[model samples]
Target: MAIPDGLDRIELTGLRGFGHHGVFDHERRDGQEFGVDVVLGLDLTAAGTTDDLAETVHYGELADSIHGVLVGPPVDLIETLALRMVDLCLTDARVQWASVTVHKPNAPITPTFTDVAVTIERSRR
Candidate 1:
């Protein structure tokens, strides 16, 4: 789904972690670096007006939470990782929607490539 209109975004990009997530045995044995980007859509009116930390989602906590997921159980697909991130983002009641991207830079591909990524968008409905 598209991000709702009139919502402000808190973007956390290039959060890195190591994970044993891949289909190949070698990949599972030797963990690799992964990058995560999250765009959280929320109404920032309260925080903007009041200048209160409680009025907004704490990005540091969110980043740590996402990193926890990244370092947690092994998964076979980046798609699954992305979905888990979306779920995490939606846990915050203030978030109206979330766009998550999981980037696998060292994907097992024959041809040289810059990166491989999976993106998922989820909304609170």
Candidate 2:
């Protein structure tokens, strides 16, 4: 997807983790793998000009933070997980907005689907 409007984006895709997040008791008990995608919006001017990591969002740190949220808690919905990820992205003052998608590839559903996911976007105010 294209970056929205005037903001520069830093994207992380296919971040995998195992978590106990589901409505079913068996799901929470056994846990399952989850994939996260995050798009962070901000101005890259300073970083681009100076070529300094401090002037931009450090993606390695961001990935670790996202993983922390993924493996940290047990929420019943991917929507909630997406919100948590958005919150993490917004922790950086430079990040003006964030879009998050939480993918549940192995969700317990009949008929067998490729994936199930929830997406959320939040902007700093």
Candidate 3:
């Protein structure tokens, strides 16, 4: 779905963590660095006016949450990892939508490739 109109954007980029997420056994056994980028759509008017941390998402905490998801468990696909991160973004009531990108720079491939990634978007129902 498209991002809702009038929603402010809070973006976090290059969030790096170590994870064991891949389709191969060696990938799961030997963890590699992963990167994540997130974009949150929400109304920040209250936070702007009130100057209160509670009125908006605490990005540090959000980072921690994302990091936990990245490092907590092994998954077969980056798509699943992206989905989990997006779910964390929607935990806050004010978030109208979230976009997540999961990056795997060390994917096991014969050809020389810079990176592989999966991205997903979700909105509140």
For model 3 the local lDDT of residue 23 reads: 90
| Alpha-carbon TM-score of each model against the true structure | 0.96, 0.94, 0.95
Per TM-score, the best of the predicted structures is 1
lDDT string, candidate 1, 12-91, tens digits: 99999999999999989999999999999999999999999999999999999999989889999999999999999998
User: Given candidate 2, what's the lDDT at residue 5?
Assistant: 83
For model 2, residues 34-99, the per-residue Cα lDDT tens digits are: 999999889999999999999999999999999998988799999999998898888899999899
Candidate 3 weakest lDDT stretch, 10 residues: 1-10
Query: What lDDT, from 0 to 1, does candidate 1 have?
Result: 0.94
Displacement of residue 124 (Cα, Å) in model 1 is 1.8
Candidate 2 segments exceeding 4 Å error = 1-3
The lDDT of each candidate is 0.94, 0.91, 0.93
User: lDDT: which is higher, 1 or 3?
Assistant: 1
Candidate order by TM-score, decreasing, is 1, 3, 2
- By lDDT, the best candidate is 1
Steric clash pairs (candidate 3): none
> If ranked by lDDT, best first, what sequence of candidates would result?
1, 3, 2
